[model samples]
Target: MEKKAAEKRVQELHTLLNQYNYEYHVLDHPSVPDAEYDQLMRELTDIEAQYPDLVSPESPTQRVGGEILSAFNKVEHKIPMLSLGNAFNEADLRDFDRKVKQAVGDDVEYVCELKIDGLAISLHYENGLFIQGSTRGDGTIGEDITANLKTIRSIPLRISQPMTIEVRGEAYMPKKSFEKLNQQKEENGEEPFANPRNAAAGSLRQLDPRIAASRNLDIFLYAIGDFSETGATTHHDGLNLLEKLGFKVNKEREKCTSIEEVIQYVQKWVEKRPHLPYEIDGIVIKVNSFVQQSELGTTAKSPRWAIAYKFPAEEVVTRLRDIELSVGRTGVITPTALLDPVRVAGTKVQRASLHNEDLIREKDIKIGDHVVIKKAGDIIPEVVNVLVERRTGEEKEFLMPTHCPECESELVRLEGEVALRCINPKCPAQIREGLIHFVSRNAMNIDGLGEKVISQLFSHELIHDVADIYRLQKDQLLALERMGEKSVTNLLAAIEKSKSNSLEKLLFGLGIRHVGAKAAKTLAQQFGNMNELKKATREELTAIQDIGEKMADSIVSYFENEEAISLIQELEAAGLNMNYTGPMPVQVESISSSLAGKVVVLTGKLEQLTRNEAKEQLEALGATVTGSVSKKTDLVIAGADAGSKLTKATELGIEVWDEEKMLEEFNR
Candidate 1:
């Protein structure tokens, strides 16, 4: 029980447990029995408790998770996590191959890896010790999930070589783990996860790392963020190096000398996918040589040297038992097809979106009709078609309802729109949906105010509007079905915290007709304050790029409404912050007019500034930042590894500027 003896024992336990963990979780071969491993872990935990100073983050006991996180902090990826282009057919693969060969020559080799159907993650190591891990948020930025990621036993706390590195991978839940977890969920009267991918994602995103640790997640470290540190010549070499460093590299990867061989690998996996212990949606084909990859370069979004060959969607037929209608926040009535329960794309599907009345009518969907369904992009189930031959004579033709299903208001199809809409401002369904949107993650982000709680509050008449949420009493919440003292306290604290959010969150939470998160940010930056925004005319609003005439009209009309003005005053009275808290907008007169009125697009990674900073700078200099390149694009700021946008810019004969040129222009 002495400090010296405890320290030595802790170190020994670390070595033994880490090795055993690697053997069991990564290598799938346990040299020791489960009881033995557990006993050692318990000893380590007890020793650490006895000599608290001897405990370290690298200890095996730390894998069980520590404290709960209040919020996930934003992490900027030093190397951008660029997405791969996808190929759905043999022709697409051949096309990708031809392009790769054309750019890097036919002497190229390709490494084929299984495209894991899970969450993408980046792991950062400093001198071989796992420092941080994050989700692939918007490529350049991600949410810090180090605590959650540490729970995955396959992920080593320390690498072998004691070198700094950033590696990328896919974190997943195995089929067995997913089944067991879902079974537990069902037994507990909780909704089971739709698929392993969803379950994995949900586990990793949990505010409590203990929840993630319980999920039994796994990972496969595939690509190194930078291979220069290890002197790896090829993608295959990098994978081998990762494996040597105590990382779980997928052993199913193959090195193909030709595109034909790559095609065979893809085809082989397509047939063998169902048998794998974990789910794989596709095969990722990458040019093997690092030199060739550099030669080929990337487009705006994806790499030219790599493509993911997505498996064909699984299709199944189910009976459309009934048509269900729901009212959206915008009062648009959406039709959903309630079908007989069936499994497709590794998930149970009992409902598919019918989109709108036009889609329903065009497909001629009827009650009790057998319909073919498939997952679009392996997520949303949709009605591919109807099997007319299998339709029973008793099938009833469906029609769009003439009234709002919730509020009993008459529905009308607005001009230039195909769907029926309920214009009733006070409709209970719209109010409920709007409240849900207002408290969403991208909006006010009140932590414990979930959809279920919101629905309960609405039904109980404890909250009628978003502002009413702030006025909620603790006693009122405590009286609700599931709201415990702790739950009510946390909910109230979260609601209080949201009142201090920047103007963009408030603007997005308002649910303006045509304004999205991006547009909301833009507006917040431009106007600086809610008072200025309220005074903006249609002409002034449209002058800002990305704001169209329709959007401008919507904004102007929204501000003119007395009810909206009253609601804004109410929110302001509730101690909500009204000023923009982000970077200040550049003054028009201070910057050069050279880029004035030009449609500009930024691509790839910039060394000096983030994509957003560069975008704001460009916009301040009178350049309009757009996502895509077209003939209308006046200029393109191409950065490191610039992808398809750069190619398209060249193809269209548009002006292209490198980072240096852009910086020089900004200086001028």
Candidate 2:
């Protein structure tokens, strides 16, 4: 065909294909048969191939996939993508309503939307043509995954109006898509994703856009990132404008005039959430009017005009078949309830932590008894309470074992501790658990070194300690049951790569007593090098912010141990990084603010600065920002509707300041 004819034909196909995509994906209605759409797409592809110059970025055929990205580039959001304050219960929602009414009056209206449990995305457009799409990285900066995002059919390549805009939405995997993906993963001997949220996130983050395309991801545009260009007066108006521009806007949204209406809508969804094709964690309630939103203002972390009402963790009753004990890296004997499989909070639950003997006794748990189970914070499965009335006479009483289940060592309850501990330093369970922790995602993060692989290596005696991982021979790895040449090569590469990780990773991997991931990072920042940390006196460690007396004592004890010191030397010999590579700790002497060296607690909300922004600025001046108010709190900066923390601060006679006062101090 000639270039001119091909160009006209290509434009016609673009219109037809984009309309079909919107009809099928966005509107959930198809105007034509699949074969018709496929034939037109093929014709367009052929034409584009023949006249290469006619191929354009906005062509519907371009949605198939793009060239693999070497790395995702950082994108800074023009307007910061602030998070919403959470309202977990009715009372919380009522309080949020009261606060909103106080600022915007009782004439307020709210737009209630289902908070889709998926990855947040921002799509940018110029002249109604899709240009870039990014992830919500840290609210301010995000990664550009434009190529991957283009694969979602629901996202339009070109809008109806020829105007520039940026829209915000959520990219998600439907329930059937998630199940099919997991099934394929299981058949291929790959680990399945935990939930739809994780699956959607993993799909979008793929380096190859083709992989993302294959995942069948969909999107629902909710808000306009910049409504200034669209002439939108309210949040609801912005959503309507997005829908008109060929974006997939969720249809279940409702406009509520009163808090009662919002509550009813939220309550209705709590029961209907499970039936939806896509998962939703909660309902997002926002003041409808843009003017009202601006008038109410925002906090340092979240907007005061909007609040997310998180659904209570989904609970289900299951029979407790047995009580199992497992030893941790710290040798704590934790009891887990082995329950009959039941679905809760988007995942199947068969095991729930009983935590300790005290919890079991307090809850009156027994084998073969029906117990109410829930995902604590929608992540960890735990037994909420026992259905005492539903218990059968055959139910067996559960008792704590006298010895450690793994190594048969005498279990003893430590002073001021509720859980039983196995004190045997050489316990295989302790060693194995420690080895697993070392290669975990937050630790050394050695890819391909998963729990099952670690178990195989341990059973074969090819690996003993964390250092043994670095010393692994390719031949030794090849000899393992399921290990192949490619797997072994990849494992070795990952192990080698981990050796160059920052000092904080190694510190967290070491499984230090009383030292969490955050504390490990803090300690690494404070000391800079492993040598300095090893030689740190208890007083010097305690003087550092976030390091308490107990934590300092634990650190001192860990360093004093001859075995730990030997292991450290072995790790250093393995060529692991020993110096901190991340951002350095702020020196108090460098900052002129009086807030320096003070334990400051930020409560309620701030209007001028975001909660995170305020906290960050405070920390930059060497002040410690803590969550709770206590007697040790040197200062309390309270914002709108100062809560219990402010009351406690006043009762404790601690210095308190309003947002204005705090801002004044910050300005100085």
Candidate 3:
């Protein structure tokens, strides 16, 4: 095809795909099947590949996201995003209504919309084209997350008309998406996000846009930031306009004629909130008319015209059957309350975490006692309080175990720590948990070694520790239940592949107390080899950045144990790599180094090295990279859309550099 023909085809494809995206994401009605969408996308990608200049920012292909960002640049909101005051009861609602009536007169109406439990966001569009998106940080300033926001399909890239406006919405993970994401996180041995709101916030804030895209996030535009520019006389009208402009708007909103009607709406939703597809913590009540809202005025932090009615946490009474204790890989003995199965926040409740012995005593919970239970954050089940009035003399007081539940080793509470720990390295339960951690993604990354598989192997006595994994034979794995020939073969291959992992993997897999993944990587780079690290004293370990006294002591104590020595030797005998093969931490101490002795702060997006890479580079040059700007900070590396950090640096009269200047120094 000719260049002109291809260009025309590209334009046609863009309009078609945008429509499809709006239907599937914004409208929740997809006209074309996913396969057809992919085919058209492929065709457009081919045309763009043949002609690079044809690739535009607004192209449908740009939604896939770009390379990892160095840092999020900050954005200052043109119109400060005010938060809403909350109403917990009818009295509070009446108080809010009274205030609104006092300011705007007796005739008033309220628009009630679902208060989405998610991250607040600001989307900016230029000439009907989506340009930038950011968080509502501190109301006035936010982090620019345009690349990440673009990945959310519900957000339209273009509107119906050529208009520049800022829209506010809540970016949330649906209940189903949150559950699926938590399942994946658990399978990967990662802590599950507390709720949909937190999960959405964490996903959107990820420096890698690809990570955010994978989380399957959605959004609902509620209010326009610049209400006057939108020409909407009422809050309900603004929502309609937003929907007409190709933005996803929640359809469950209602316009109530009076305060009593508003209260009724809130009461109705409080019971039905859990049934919704997504999580909503409360309902937002706003005076309907723009004139009424303006007349009602605002507080320093919240708008008097609008208030949030938070749903009271649903609590249920269940019998506490028993208190079960589980030993973690870190040897922390955590108590769990085993309760009669009851539903809370849409999930069945069986067990809730009892953080420490102090909590148990403070709550005065007893076995056989009726207890109130609720989902702590609509995700984690927790014991709220005991129904002492219903408790009879038949209830038995629960006692904390003095010894490890699995290994029977004496438990001890460490100084400055609330957890009772079993410090014995050879505890059977600890070994099993450690093996599970060893094959985790951040550790050895051994495929096909899930907790179930690891537990099976542990039960059969085929694997005792991390080293025993490398020594496993095909015959032994085949003997296990459900371990087929192909399964054993694949498992062996993944195990063999992990043998060549850099020293950091092995360091983390060792499960040394207080040594997390980051610290393990630092130690691996600092020592360059396991033997060097094993020989390092506490003083030598503490010399590394981010390594504090506790971590240094733990590392020295871990390697000093006889079992630790034997494990390392066994690992080496099985032909595992023991050398650091990643980017070495710079050890240059030259006084003339450009970034030497400087307390540097990095902010915004860098096109070249990643944020961690940049930090590592600066550290190598003897620069201390701090998270925030202070009077002690000597320089600030500013990239595109640098926010509060850049402003503070300027105010402090500190030196600032862009990515280009930073790279210039890096090359030197």
lDDT of 2 by residue, 256-374 (tens): 99999999999999999988988898999999999988898887667899999977668899899999889999999998999899978777778999998889899999899999998
What TM-scores do the predictions have?
A: 0.77, 0.80, 0.67
lDDT of 3 at 372: 93
- Give the Cα lDDT of each candidate: 0.88, 0.87, 0.86
lDDT minimum window of 10 residues, candidate 1: 183-192
Candidate 1 regions exceeding 4 Å error are 30-36, 63-86, 92-111, 119-128, 131-148, 160-168, 173-216, 223-245, 255-261, 275-277, 286-307, 531-562, 586-668
Candidate 3 per-residue lDDT, tens place, 1-668, comes to: 78999999999999999999998987778999999999999999999999999999899999867799999998999887776777889999999889888887888989999999888999999999999999986566679999999999889888888899999999999988988998886664355676677788889889889989999999999989888977899999999999889899999999998988988898889888768998888899999999988887786657889998878778899999999999999899999999999867655578999888899899998889999998753567888899999977999988888999999999999899999999997899888999999998789999788888898889988888888899889999888887789978988999999999999998998888888777888889888999999999988878877787988999989888998899899999999999999886565565467898888999975433447768877887888787789898989998644679999999989999976567657645
Between candidates 2 and 3, name the one with more favorable TM-score: 2
572-597, model 1: which lDDT tens digit per residue?
A: 99999999998775655675679877
Rank by lDDT, descending? 1, 2, 3
Tally clashing residue pairs in candidate 1. 5
What's the distance in Å from true for residue 105, model 1? 9.2
Give one clash count per candidate, in the order shown. Answer: 5, 3, 0
TM-score of 2: 0.80
Best by TM-score: 2
lDDT of 3: 0.86
